[model samples]
Target: MRLTIDHRTTYRFTAPQGRVVQLLRMTPRNTHDQTVAAWDINIDCDARLREHRDGFGNITTMLYAEGPLSGIEISVSGEVVTSSSSGVLHGTFEPLPAALFLRSTPATHAEPALAAFAQAATVGRAPIAALHALNAAVHERFTLVDGRPEAGLTVTAAFARETATARDLAQMFVAAARAAGFPARYVTGYCDALPNGRPTPHGWADAWVEGLGWVGFDPTLGRSPEAHHVRVAVALDAAGCSPVAGSRLGEGREWLDVEVQVSGQD
Candidate 1:
């Protein structure tokens, strides 16, 4: 399948800021299962973007703009060709050892409850099967809410609510998979949505299979991803894979809006 993505993020503020800086992880890299045919990024305001690759191998863009500006927009458009790899990631350069992902971040910390849940979910299974079981268990246990969850909610917190956005669920899956002794990471990207409906950006978890390398699982969908998924950025936690993250020079209440549309062609 060939997929196209149009993602735009806009920021509006109550007062003008002196400057704004952002890190963009919106570009998709070519993998064995995915090929990037075209990609571009545009900013509505005056800014200089410097591109670099991060440790996790994600393509990062640094955006800097001097502003007495009230708003800014970042737009990303791209096309990719993807094929099913049975969830295994191959042919991409991975700079960090898989064990590095075993180290926990605050968002994915494995508390006793999470550890116990992981143990219960994967009892008597092989590593690959265990990951599949954990993925399905997470889907069965939690519901996908329509909107994003409140910011900064941890894996345990999402479990308490019994529902969360894809981002939170992916984070939970990362935490649980790590507790189960599998190195895991968070992936942010695009996926096909229902026909004629606007597609939103997606998030999922990837676990290192002893013989299979990294395999992706989407707890939100209760299955491993296939050709419909276009992977963009990956990291130990969601924040690191976020499409855009930034800070402003001036202090004022800011409102954010994001729009994403993903379509596919045979």
Candidate 2:
């Protein structure tokens, strides 16, 4: 399958700023199952973009802009070709050991209730089957919602809700999988399966199975990711792999708008 993606993020501030700096994990890397064919990032204003890799081995771009500016627009467009991998990752860069993903971040901390739920959901099953069960359980537990995820929402809080955004569901799955004794991490990427375009990129989880290495899981879809999924960044939690994280020197208030479109063809 060939996939095309167009993503734009805009930030408008009530007060002009002196400077802005951002770290972006919006670029996808090539793996055995997916190949980046073409990619570009455009900033509406004068800015400097430096490419580098983060600790998690994700391709990152650092943006620096001088201000007195009211707003900034960051746009990214790309094309990628992917093949069905049955959710098993291969030929991807791995900078850290799988055990590192087992470490929990604040956003993915599993409280007692969540931990117990994980235990109950996966009991009496083999590792792979248990992971599938946990994924389905997480999917069944929430009413999937769309739009930007609530900032700083933790897994425990999200798990308590009857509705959750993709980010929340992914984080919940990561937390639960870790509690179930599986080394898991959060993933931020794009999926071509949505009928309508989305305002934000997709989110999911990946777990390290002993014999299988890393395998993808989408609690939002209640299945493993395949050709329709374009894998990007992976980290202990969403914040660690956020597509954009930045700070402005001056700030009164700011409004953000995001638009994303992902389409695929065989």
Candidate 3:
């Protein structure tokens, strides 16, 4: 499948600022199951973009801009060809040991309730089957929301809620997987399964199975990622692989808006 993506993010500040700096993990890399055919990032204002790879091997870009400005926009367009990998990752960069992913971040801390739930969901099952059962359990337990996830929402809080965004679900999955004695990590990227588009990028979780290496599971979709999924960045939690993370030397308040479209063809 060939997929095309258009993503734009805009920020409006209540007061003028002096400077802005951002770290972006918006670019996808080539893996055995996926190939980047073309990609570009455009800034609406004058900014300097330096490209580098992060500790997780994600393609990252640093943007620095002089600002007395009220707003700025970041636009990304790309094309990628992907093949069905049955959710098992192949030929992808892995700098750190898989055990590192077992470490929990603030957002993915598994509280007692979540840990117990994981234990109950996967009990008496094999490793691979147990992961599938856990994924299905998560999907059945929460209603999936389609919009921006609440900032700084933790897995414990999201698990208590009746509904969850993709990010929240992914974080919850990571927490549960870790609690279940499986090394897991958060993933941020694109999926072309939506009818039109989404306000933000997609998210999922990957777990390290004994014989499978790293396998992708999307609790949001209750299935393993297929050809429609474009894998980008992976980290201990969403914040680590967040598409944009930065600070602006400004005052007052700021408003943000995001738009993402992903279309695929065979």
TM-score for each of the candidates: 0.97, 0.98, 0.97
Clash totals for all models, in order?
Answer: 0, 0, 0
Kindly report which residue pairs in candidate 3 clash with one another. none
* Of candidates 2 and 1, the better by TM-score: 2
lDDT of each: 0.89, 0.93, 0.92
Cα error of candidate 3 at position 153, Å: 0.9
Candidate ranking under lDDT, highest first, comes to 2, 3, 1
Identify the runs in model 3 with alpha carbons over 4 angstroms from their true place: 195-199
Kindly indicate the candidate among 1 and 3 with the higher TM-score: 3
In model 2, how large is the Cα lDDT of residue 227? 95
Q: Return the candidate ranking by TM-score, descending.
A: 2, 3, 1
- Residue range 1-266, candidate 1, lDDT tens digits: 99989999999989999999989999888999999999999999899999999999999999999999899998999999999988888887799999999989988898899889999999899999999999999888876776655788888777778667888888999999999999999999999853243466789989999878999999988899999999999999998789888999998899998899888887
| Prediction RMSDs, each to the true structure | 1.5, 1.1, 1.2
